[model samples]
Target: MLRIKKLDIFVLKSFLLLFAGTFFICLFIFMMQFLWRYVDELVGKGLEINVLAQFFFYSGLTLIPLSLPLAILLAALMTFGNFGERYELLSMKAAGIPLLRIIRPVVLFCVFLGGMSFFFQNIIGPRAQKQLWTLLVSMKQKSPEVDIPEGVFYSDIDGYNIYVKHKDRKTGLLKDILIYNFSDGFENAHIIWAAEGKLELTADKQHLFLHLYNGEQFENLKSQSVISRNVPYRRETFKEKHTLIQFSSEFNMVDGSFLDRRSDIKNMHEISVAIDSLTTHADSVGRSMYSDIMSTTYRGAVLTPADSVKIKTENIAVINTDSIYNSMTSQEKLKVLTTTENRVKSLSTDWDMKSFLTKDTDNSIRSHRSDWHKKITLSLACIIFFFIGAPLGAIIRKGGLGMPVVISVLIFVIYYIIDSGATRVAKSGEMNIVLGTWMSTIVLAPLGAFFTYKSNKDSVVFNLDVYAAFFRKLLGIRQSRHMFKKEVIIHTPEYAKDIEILDEISKDCQTYLETHRLKGMPNYIQIFTNNKHDDAIAEISKKMEALIEELSNTKDAVLLNLMNNYPFLSVKAHKSLFDNRWLNLLFGIIVPAGLLLYLNIWRYRLRLEKDLRVIIKTNQSIIEQIEKQQLYLQK
Candidate 1:
């Protein structure tokens, strides 16, 4: 039997409360998004309160798999973050408790959550999905309530358009009603205008009755020849008239099996069975298509006469089309050509439809198989997210919803993006369904293990200074010196004079740019072929660094500010050469490389121009600051 310690109970109590709140928060967020999609179907249909409640309930249940993983991730991040922020983790470490030992309870609970997620997916989720969609389809089928306002044309009903000039909602009456009925056909349209009318639903809500008083009706007589310039029509006047329209207002749920047979409406077992059945059916259709192609299209078209099998036409008469066409008179030939064109068109259309059906069926099978793999992958994601979130929170050591929420949401968004992309690829048969479905886990599990290891060892995995240094090295950039070294000044003179050092460097750079033709395409081509620009740029960079170093000994604040701006000039010809060499080698010498290299060179040129501007401005500021310092000393 297992034993429970006080520490275990304490951790569990705190984590479970946060987990429960976070789970519902995730559910509410997803439900809001769900409502956005189906609001059109639910609203204006006047569905019963219980019916709406059932719809939302089923929708929430169906979203369990999606919400569970995100919830676990956020809950774990918050739980550990709170512990780290409160110094509980630090206290535990000082007490000789391992990080994993502290996290053992949360891990066990997450494992149980993962199992619950799996059960929800396999059993409750599918039924909820079926009921949700069934309700949705039923809502769409029910007639929209007749709330036609005044002075507007409403075309909600099929094959009918109605206009009401004035509506009296209190009296349930419409004045000056105009109705256009094209149910028979557009050419045989019937138009009715009424002085006053009332629209009401039948007791069973299966039909609409329009009772009109002082109405006139006119109907076109389509029996007249279409070539006649004038259409024959009939008109009638009535003191009272009525019409019955077929409209179903009741919400009748579709046969449960209709959408239940869809890929989304099944567990892994059912989906696997569907996959097999669809596969077999698809195979049979393909084989039959291949047989028809071999027997019909290639009947007499083979290169080898002996190998070409003559397709039999039992109980069918065959005619020599070419000779018969040649023997036909001109009029007869026209008739034959027209008939043949129609026949060919019909055959082409039939084959096109068949090809479309075959492709659709193939995609359906892939979708089913992909959904089957998703059942397991989604459950696995909950455990993966817990592993990642808990260790990362421990390593970061900051608490509450601030940093933890951002990190958790960022990680989950990345996971969702990868999972969505993989699902699309799998559904399109670009990759195997299982591999695509598990791609996120395969990519992130190692990362989770690494975080776990680092957290257990108390490593600063989220340390920004370390990462900053590494990034600088990777990009071949030199890091800036934040602290200035104390230097002994051998001479203290001339604070009033203008600085010639920055001016000289700026002059040299401007002169070099003016002399060198690094602007246009011709100059770009010339530079790469034993380019002297590279050597010149490299020399200028060295001089700039040397100038900044000598001036670093100065105690002038403006001079120090100017020195801070000099390191940006380090991003020059050398870094671009080596940094982009990998690009050229991978993309090759011509085509993509040529265009890309050209663009990169132009970008460097723009940066060089910006550097010259900075140099000139810094020299001017140093000159002004020195003048100010000299005036202050004199005062």
Candidate 2:
């Protein structure tokens, strides 16, 4: 038992739901077309309902192998797309899960589907197709009701018009039947009229028989213009049956041995027989060539002796001396040589004829061998189609009607084109069958593998990044920058100016307090003072008024502007300024006290020195002293 993870189970469930929907949608659409095909046949040939139903059923079964792969591809793509969109894929990757591991279940599912397809193709598919074809044949045989729409001219079994006044559904009978038999040659035609008719199914369910009563038959004979025959009482019947309809041989044949006989077996037997014939012919040609060569050689030897005898007889005639002592003349000797040469030439011609016959036999044997190889190659296409479909679906990753249909059609088209071309070449004796039929599979398998690899990598080859990169290269756009070196700078002269003004005001107030404290109270101070320091109080009040007037009169518009701008700059500048260790320590302790006390007296001294440098056009040593003092405090 396989223990599936919760996530894997969820993924599988989602995929299956999608897959089932796609499969059924595809199946229904295909089945509709299948039904339409038979419907046309039924209408044209007047077929039966039972046969039509069986035709659709078997047609549905035959199409399952084609639809399964499409469903699988669609389901997988949707499943993976959902995972990717939800960031589940990212999560899984972060958790150290490999993509291959995630898709293992999908691959396993596809394998199971492939197995089912194989079962259907090898066993169920063929049987279903055979049954469907049988049913169609039977329907043709059983000439059922010709469903003619009212008021429309519908053709009868014999390709003639049939008109019905009315039809009784309960009785399955028509009140009137008028048939024009155009089946006969156009010049000689016949018209059939029946008062009433009923459609009947044959006892064996192999044919539909039409029974008519009270009818007249009219015919136009070529020699005799027109003829009409009428009867007081008449009975006519029409029968239509499919000739190819037959029971399986096993049912008819009593012998169990004959049950195995089939067309496929006969085809195989024919091929084997052809091969054997070719072999026998080759062997016969070889033996014939050997015998012919031997005969020619022996004939050549006999011809030489015959020519010599003739030559000797001629030479004796040419000689005029006594028979015992006479010698052949030069002309007689030359004539003897010429006769021998002609005999040798005749033997060589016979040998050449034998050689030509042997070459022709060898060529015939090679041709037959090529044909045998081609037949065997074509027979193995079923398995090749399986490989092509399964892997291709896995790679495409789209299993629904839309993508699957387009892809299946395109892939099959290519496969068919290649296979057809190869077959043509092979048949024409241009190439061998092994190369032709298997070539398509060999080419497409790698393409499927490439797609599968891309799919597994979660790579969308047509994505924005890919397109951008392509165009970027085409336009030659290339530049690089160091992002880390760029820093945001903040300037804060406003805060320092505000601190200088605050220091001046604090110093003047401290000087007034010290001067008042040094003076003793006058004698009448008790009378005016709420406590007994009346004189001191009056003097302090006068001095405080003077100080307030001076402070108010002092134009600190620049300091006010500085104060207003400091808040805005402080937030921005704090991080950058405090990033330095010394600045962080100094400001962290002093800034809070300085803000509370308004104690910018030391800061004002530094500011006065800066103002002196600007106004007097002279370097100020006080600014240096302030910086040195602040530095010493830090040390």
Across residues 1-635, which tens digit of lDDT does each residue of candidate 2 receive? 87789767775687678778867866787788777776755565543455456667788887776566545544455555556556676687678776666665766776677667666655566467556555655554544454655555675445456677778887776776676666667655666777777766566745556677677667765553235352232344443211122211111112323322222212334545655776787788778877866775664554566765886777744533355224667787677678769877987887788778766654544444443443333333333433344334434444445654565566656766886787566545567655754576567666656655665565675467778867754443322211121143243224234335444434543554455332332222111121222243334335433432332322333322222211101111111222355543454357565342222323332333332223122112222333454476589
How many residue pairs clash (N, CA or C atoms closer than 3 angstroms) in each of the candidate models, in the order given? Answer: 0, 14
Cα lDDT of model 1 by residue, 1-635, tens digit: 66889999998888888889989999999999999988886678878888889888999999988998888888888888888889998898899999888888888888888888888888998888999988888888877887887888998777889999998979999999999999999988999999999999999888899999999999988765657788789999999998998877777778777785688889888988888898889899989988886776556332245433332324325546688679889999898778768867876886898799798988888888878778888888888888898898787777788998899889989998989999898888789877888898898889889999999998888789899978875554556545364477765434433366556767877887688554544343432443233566667677767766666666776667756765455444522444344453444356566666656666667656666667667667766776777788789
Question: Residue pairs in steric clash, candidate 1?
Answer: none
Which candidate tops TM-score? 1
The C-alpha lDDT values of all candidates are 0.79, 0.51
* Candidate 1 ranges beyond 4 A from true positions: 221-231, 301-354, 482-635
Question: If scored against the real structure, what TM-score would every candidate get?
Answer: 0.71, 0.43
